[model samples]
Target: MSLTLRIILLIGSLISFYLCVKKIKQAKLKVENSITWMMGSFVLILMSIFDQAVQWLANKLGFMASVNFVFFIIIVFLLIQVFIDNIRLSTLNEKIKNLNHYIALKENSDEREKNVKE
Candidate 1:
């Protein structure tokens, strides 16, 4: 690879690592999430280093190039993650709604009991 390309990849890898660390420190990302991000970034760095090897495999497999394959993989992973996140959020929302309903019912019952006592 060209010196420029190598330098750019190094910079990108460093930036990704730094961001992942910062997110973990700030509690913005859980440990598991940070680990996943770090692993993805590491894979990107490896792809950068072994680009030629990847290209050779791509060629053998009849794909266009390594870069294209990497992009496709990243897109698929992102879509799957988004789907999982949506499912988790929906479940959380349902739980919150159920809790709210339960609290309302309890309050109503308590009020009725107080009125009867008086």
Candidate 2:
């Protein structure tokens, strides 16, 4: 990795980490959701600090350049994050559907009892 790239990575990761913390402090972001951001920032920081290791790994992984490896890692991490979010959304949707069905049934049952009492 070039010195400039390493410096940029370091700065970017630091900024990302700072933003996550700021959002959490402002109650704009939940800690659970911020965990992935924090972890990703940490990984980038490590990569920036260990340029030699990044280069070696890139070579071993058959990437033409260490920068390409960094980008690949970032893309993969984002994909995983998106998958996790989708799973959470799916679960929430199922719960909402079940709750709506239960509510409809309760309303129907109540109406029948009211008619019987009348």
Candidate 3:
């Protein structure tokens, strides 16, 4: 491999390792999941460098010279999923805030009515 490819792989591996460690430390990811992520990252890095591997399969399966196509498609799909999840979370948050505000308003109105009656 060329020096540049070696450097890229090293950097990618380090980044993947760092992410796995961070996730584990934060309790956001289980050990198994972290390991999977780390392994996936390594594979992705390897695929990035040895693009011919993807091409060979693609050709065997009747895909064109667009080995990078699969990678980009996966990236776009993940990004869309992330965006959709973020939107859903934001909507739920807004609903919760509105419910809280409505409850507070109702409680205050009830108190006012009780005081007036007294």
Taking all chains together, each candidate's TM-score versus the true structure is 0.82, 0.88, 0.52
Which digits, one per residue and each the tens of the lDDT, describe model 2 over residues 70-107? Answer: 99999999999999999999999999999999999999
Model 1 residue 70 CA deviation (Å) reads 1.7
TM-score of 1: 0.82
Best of the candidates, TM-score: 2
- Relative to the unseen true structure, what is the C-alpha lDDT of residue 83 in candidate 2, on a scale of 0 to 100? 100
- The lDDT ranking, best first, is 2, 1, 3
The per-prediction CA RMSD against the true structure, in angstroms, equals 2.3, 1.6, 4.7
Compose the digit string of candidate 3's lDDT tens values, residues 23-113.
8999998897466557656666776667666667667767655444555645775686578669979999999999999999999999999
Question: By the lDDT metric, which is better: model 1 or model 2?
Answer: 2
**Lowest lDDT 10-mer window, candidate 1?**
1-10
Q: Give the backbone clash total of model 3.
A: 0
Give the per-residue lDDT digits (tens) of candidate 1, residues 2-113.
Answer: 5566567667877988998998899898887677668777876787788787678777887765657767766886787789789989999999999999999999999999
The alpha-carbon deviation from the true structure for residue 97 of candidate 3, after best TM-score superposition, in angstroms, is 3.4
lDDT scores in order:
0.78, 0.97, 0.71
Q: After superposition, how far is residue 109 of candidate 1 from its true place, in Å?
A: 1.4
Error of 1 at 79 (Å): 1.1
